[model samples]
Target: MMQRTISTTKHWIVIVLMSVLGCGLLIQGGYMQAKAHFAQFLIERAFEQTLVDNQPHKPWSWADTHPVAKMRVLQQQTDGFQPLGSDLYVLAGASGRNLAFGPGLMLGGAGLGEQGNTIIAGHRDSHFMRLQYVKLGDIIELYSTEGERVLYQITATEVVHETDMKVLAPTAEKHLTLITCYPFDQLSGNAEYRYIVEAKPIDAQPLYS
Candidate 1:
């Protein structure tokens, strides 16, 4: 009789342990869901601000004109973007609620329209949650302090290790490279691999009031 009672006690213990583990997992999943949702909201807000806050440029193309004409070229200068000076961009990746955390704007360069590549990074989990759905040839539009809009076309999307910042380096030609945590497999913290989206300037359209 005693042995049977002990067996029953052990069974109850196992059941309790299982229940605890299950509940822990449930709580963790909910936390992650909430975080991703918040990240999505942040990205949307940032994108909108970027569009509204870009600077304006006076349109004057000086080619093969005289030096006097160059001085005559006084175009209207528009407001430009104020750089965060950090590579921590709010991602707008996942189409749904995933933030798709990746990199934001970093140092050593100006905004989108100058020379070289302007690389941005965000988290695969939080900011870049939706990057998985991005296809080749998609458009990435950013506004600058000059009130000008910079256009980019996704030229390549790749997966690399965290050590591979080489692809994210500035190029001789203008481009925009987005870096984010890869796989999005982890429920929390940073990922091992990186997801990179490389884009180039395609076309531009003037924004008029």
Candidate 2:
């Protein structure tokens, strides 16, 4: 009888441990989802303010990050053109926390809408997830803080080692480079490769005018 009681106790202990682990996983997932939604909300507000004031705008009062640019993927057709998805706000720096919120414009690169290479980095599972669907010849529009909208056409997409620096090289012509982790579906802790998208300016005129 005592052996049976001990066996029953062991079973209950196992059940309790599993229950705690399962609850932990659920809470973690929910927190992450909430964080992503909140970040996007902040970004949207910043983007709107930037457009209204024609100046850089911070998403929140205490945030060190500010919206530097707005990006949209354009879908062109014989009859008309439309944006593929909602606008994504580009943040000032690509720190891990910043990327969790939005795409980050690399410092020391060409200023937005300028005549040099501009590099931006975003997380694969979040802000840059749609980049996988971007194809050659697809048009990308960048709205800068100065209220200038520039059009660019995708020229190339490639995968390179994470340490490759050539992809960020400076150029005399206007260019936009997007960097994200490769194998978009992978959930690994260490991302060894990067997916890069290069676009060249096709129009110099401001989009709004």
Candidate 3:
């Protein structure tokens, strides 16, 4: 009888432990989701302030990066280029942490809307997911903090190995190079290939209200 009672107690203990672990995981997931949503809100507000002041603004007080530009993808319509997605704030550094929040500008690249190649990188599954649907000749608009808007026409899209650095080399004319991991629908992480979207500056103008 004692042995049977001990076995029953052991089963109950295991069930209780598993229940605690499951709840802990649930709470952790909820916290992460909340943080992600809140972070985007802060980033958007900071980007707006940066545009107004023409200065860099951290999305959060402890953030190591700041908003440098805003980006929007557009599709050609009968009425002209229509927005395909909401504006995304491009962060200054292309670090893993910064990419988690939004696209990141590759350091040492051309300044936004300036000469040379302005490169930006983002996660394939997140901010740059729309790139997969972007066709050649689609429009990409980049807005600098100073309110200058540069329009780029998509020229090409290609897949390259992660080690292929030639796509990121400097260019003589103004260009935009967007990089994300390929293939877009992969179920696993740490993809070894990269998807490149190449664009050339076609127009520039001051953003108006």
| Per-candidate local distance difference test | 0.54, 0.84, 0.85
Comparison by TM-score, 1 against 3, better one: 3
Of candidate 3, the 10-residue stretch with the lowest lDDT total is 200-209
Model 1 vs truth, CA RMSD: 14.0
C-alpha RMSD (angstroms) for model 3: 4.9
lDDT of 3 by residue, 1-209 (tens): 99999999999999999999999977875675466557667888998998788777888889999888889998877766677777778889899888888889999899898889999998776678888999998888888888887899899999999999999899999999999999988835689999999998885432322
Off by over 4 Å in 3: 1-37, 204-209
Better of 2 and 3 by TM-score: 2
Residue runs of model 1 more than 4 Å from their true location after superposition: 1-103, 108-110, 145-147, 188-190, 204-209
How well does candidate 1 score on lDDT at residue 208?
A: 23
Point to the candidate with the largest lDDT.
3
**Model 2 ranges with Cα > 4 A deviation:** 1-30, 76-80, 204-209
TM per candidate comes to 0.58, 0.81, 0.80
Give me the overall lDDT of model 1. 0.54
Alpha-carbon RMSD of each model: 14.0, 3.8, 4.9
